[model samples]
Target: MTAGVLDEAIKKAAIAWISVGDGPAYALWCMPAESSILVVSGPGEQFAPGLAEAERATVRLRGDHGGLILVVDATVSRLTPGSDEWNELAPPLATKRLNASGTADELAARWAETGCAIVRLTPAAGSAVGAPDLPAESAAQPPRETPARVETRRPFRLHRVRKR
Candidate 1:
């Protein structure tokens, strides 16, 4: 039952919240492939720090209605460029990538040159949880500090000038 639910959720989800060991979770765009989920990260792509080095990570997926649906532990594996698995998954992933700057082949070449990582996240056996087991809290946090900020400005007021 858990495996079925997990698979379905992973299949339908375009994004998942992935947390590396002792780190805050980050929302990453992903694609489901067979029994595993594939994510591309590094330069010019979504940021998933320590994912390539980490052996395991937590994956939290939300339902269509915007509620946390499933949580699972996944074993992380990095796919080598030009390998069979990379060749098979890269095209599909590249096609699905939004706002990509180049063609699939170009992107793949760039990724290889820049050391981008294509990671596979396979759910650990019997580690899926859902529904009643999910946390009660909303888990929202304050936005991270950034250099960008709104500039203060005076409000404009319309005025009628008297005839000279």
Candidate 2:
């Protein structure tokens, strides 16, 4: 990806309309620290079985013209700001944005309150792994940001996923 594209991706936390080749393809991605999710959309003929490993999962399309694959690697930590010791781990620009208008301690505290961590991903020079150019007409827009407001509410009823 170009520097411009990478900057956009990092700023938006997602990319769309990337072009890999002369095949119909598009991807939507979300990266929150150690976890990143990607959804690939393309014709079936372009699909291929993705590589699977101990820390990775690849789901491939299962029909004619279904050549698309969704490859997710658990080992690659998604880059996150204000978490996972980002000040020391992330690139300088990422650190600055994450810690913007706040002290390092303050940012760290915020991340802790949100139950988040930071992880780094390699092949990171560009924003994404593949370069599939998408047209503006087919791209997805980012969600609108909601203003923060304080509200009073009762505590949640207790539900346990596992008993100690």
Candidate 3:
């Protein structure tokens, strides 16, 4: 069933491309929950622009081969800090975060104090499209501009080669 595929894809995905209406998709780290995904955005976390204000967004999951595997429409809800839902999800999410500087509880506290938004994405019914239904287009885009670039220079030689 489509729901089964959606659930499995969400479970396996560590990152999902989330986009609000007509906006650029931002790849965000997420943790799968019961029929939903929890994503942290804002200060000291991944920048997910417009997610906190948007009521809905599209979530794209990729396969192991790095191809698009599933797409679904999701309802976005920003969880309130210190709520029961936040209490349940934050510590686990913090634990899953790689290279974190502190304990899970400490990270969770920081997230709350530093204005991070934890958005929950719950799939809308009948919105999942599995691989078979995916569009033919690859949807690739040019990489975003950044100040960083590789420096170019002449290659170093150990010694001059003799001409023959």
TM-score of 1: 0.89
lDDT of 3 by residue, 1-164 (tens): 36777878888889999999999898899999888999999898998889999999999998888889888999999999999999999999999999999899999999999999999999999988887788998788898876786668998999998999
What does each candidate score in C-alpha RMSD?
A: 4.5, 17.2, 2.4
Better of 1 and 2 by TM-score: 1
Please rank every candidate by lDDT, starting with the best.
3, 1, 2
lDDT per residue (tens digit) for residues 45-156 in model 2: 1121221111323211111232221222233333345444455443332334321456655544454455343333322332233234322242335653446655669788
Worst 10 residues of 3 by lDDT: 1-10
What is the alpha-carbon lDDT of model 2 when measured against the actual structure? 0.34
The local lDDT score (0 to 100) that residue 55 gets in candidate 2 is 30
What's the C-alpha lDDT at position 69 in model 3?
A: 89
Q: Among all windows of ten consecutive residues in candidate 2, which has the lowest summed lDDT?
A: 45-54
- Tens-digit lDDT track of model 1 for 12-117: 9789999998898999999999888999999988989999889999999999898898989999999999999888888889888988888987887888889999
Best by the lDDT measure: 3
Per-residue error at 113 for model 2, in Å? 4.1
Number of backbone-clashing residue pairs for each candidate, in the order shown: 0, 18, 0
Estimated TM-score per prediction?
0.89, 0.27, 0.90
CA lDDT for candidate 3:
0.91
